[model samples]
Target: MNGDNRIHLVRDEIRRVSACDHATLDAVAELLGTREINVLAGRLGMVAAHMASRAGIAEGMPPPGTFPGAGNERIDLAAQWNAVTVAGWFVRKKLTAWWWHDVLFDGVLVTYELVKAFVTAVVDDDPSHITRLTLRLRALSAGRLVIEVHDSPENAHLISAADNLISPQVEHVAHHCGRHEHQGRTVLWCELARPELSRWI
Candidate 1:
């Protein structure tokens, strides 16, 4: 088949397989008329490469070294429910299914855990006070993931103490962890470099 026709066929098959409840490597291999899992993996990797290229082309420029203000994107959660709900929403909206499959599946779980810790710290500080929780996700230049948890000025002391407790829970997964202040907000940040995702190119 022609190049365009082949791409169209592959895309259609991908969409079909993605809709399946058990969309595993074996299932994809069956749908694509291939029995070799390695071949299927290589093909999918090529597809991801092409998608990245297309994105750069569509932007009429080379792929950006980093997303604009990526390390500084913040979401403010004003209440406990808001923290949990927003964290779930961010996962669903910001991450693609392909991303979950190719990399960072466990990373999402870690992020959720941290989100819970952040929310709990704020709520425990002063249940009656209106808590403001800020969450930030950034992709560093070295391809590491950095998550920042920020609290309002009123809860600064509580957040600092809470971060000390939270750090140990996440230190096994995070390469670096620390606390600081940003624009008057108390911030706790963690940087992670997953072996599987570190070679993304």
Candidate 2:
């Protein structure tokens, strides 16, 4: 069969098995090929993110947090979740549209969950303590995507707790995970390997 037909078949199968048990999905993904599954997952992630954005806007919520230079800055659980979800969609879309041609589909999902856990931990630990949160994404040299979450330097303990909360989750989808201090800001980061891009070229 031609490449396009094969891709269509694979995507249909992926959709069919997406709601099945994890083992079933894994088996089908293995049979269909990881690259094809990753592409499908990326597309699905974008769809999910778009739905989430529309839902938030429809509910009359403000856009996550103020962007840099917006004069007002605040970060809370709702804002953090919104930012990470939107960022995941943007990153995945950019990969599909640009030179990368590969997306960290599983990684994006894990990062969203991890970000939620991180935000919850902080709020539970001290509801009023965290005032600033920043998330940054960058492509690493070795075909990896790095997501860096930054917050107040004094909240080192909260960062550590978040690291512990998502350590196992991060391991499943990411190659590296750590916490550090950068220019006096506390940072938590995870590096996920991008799927091979040769097929799209």
Candidate 3:
């Protein structure tokens, strides 16, 4: 790009723009290739995670206490569950709706099927729907896994204990389905009680 073709900075932009000249921009572009540019911010190109780390943050996350609930411990179910080929494939296909599991649950036949049914009911397993599910071992409960399905606001209206949605009346397993306040959102919660779950562990 020619110097004449470069964008002219306005007064406000000049203030917000990081102190860097064309040579610096050219060096950044050459060193990083396509990754380094924030044209709108008028700043030097920096990888997001690296920038966060430099700011005393971790992997694009603000430091603890930077936000209202940043201190709470939250596990990334995807890191483990998505490693399973089938689960990863499913996530990739939908792009929005995702089925997940935490370290506690082995996600066997019954558990996996039930969780899938609950999520599919709300999102119909469609890629456009933003519904997602997470399964974790219920605290202070023996052989019980809690499945929380967080629905998109637009689709939460479809959450139900309908027979077609969740086979709650089944003979094999007795489960509880209800809504609970989780982080200010009404989460579709289900408890899967399987005493034999400990066998896998």
Q: Give the TM-score of candidate 2.
A: 0.47
**Of the candidates numbered 1 and 3, which has the greater lDDT value?**
1
For residues 1-201, could you state the per-residue lDDT of candidate 3 as single tens digits?
555445444434544544768887677667553433444222322222222323322232112121121111112232122323444333233222222333123333333444455555554535464544443322212223344334345444554432344344322443444444433444444444444422211
Candidate 2, pairs of clashing residues: none
Cα lDDT of model 2 by residue, 75-114, tens digit: 3323344656765665566545545545456646655755
lDDT of each: 0.58, 0.55, 0.37
Tell me the TM-score of model 3: 0.32
Evaluation by lDDT, superior candidate among 2 and 3: 2
- Against the true structure, what is every candidate's RMSD? 14.5, 16.7, 19.2
User: Who wins the lDDT comparison?
Assistant: 1
Arrange candidates, best lDDT first. Answer: 1, 2, 3
lDDT of 1 by residue, 1-201 (tens): 899999899889878765667546556557664445666566465444434433332422222233334333457777575676676566544545324322265445555667777777778767888867777666543245566666777776666666453445566776666555445556565656546433332
Q: Estimate each model's TM-score.
A: 0.52, 0.47, 0.32
Worst lDDT run of 10 residues, candidate 3, spans 64-73
Better of 1 and 3 by TM-score: 1
| Ranking, TM-score, top scorer first | 1, 2, 3
Clashes of each: 0, 0, 0
Pick the winner on TM-score between candidates 1 and 2: 1
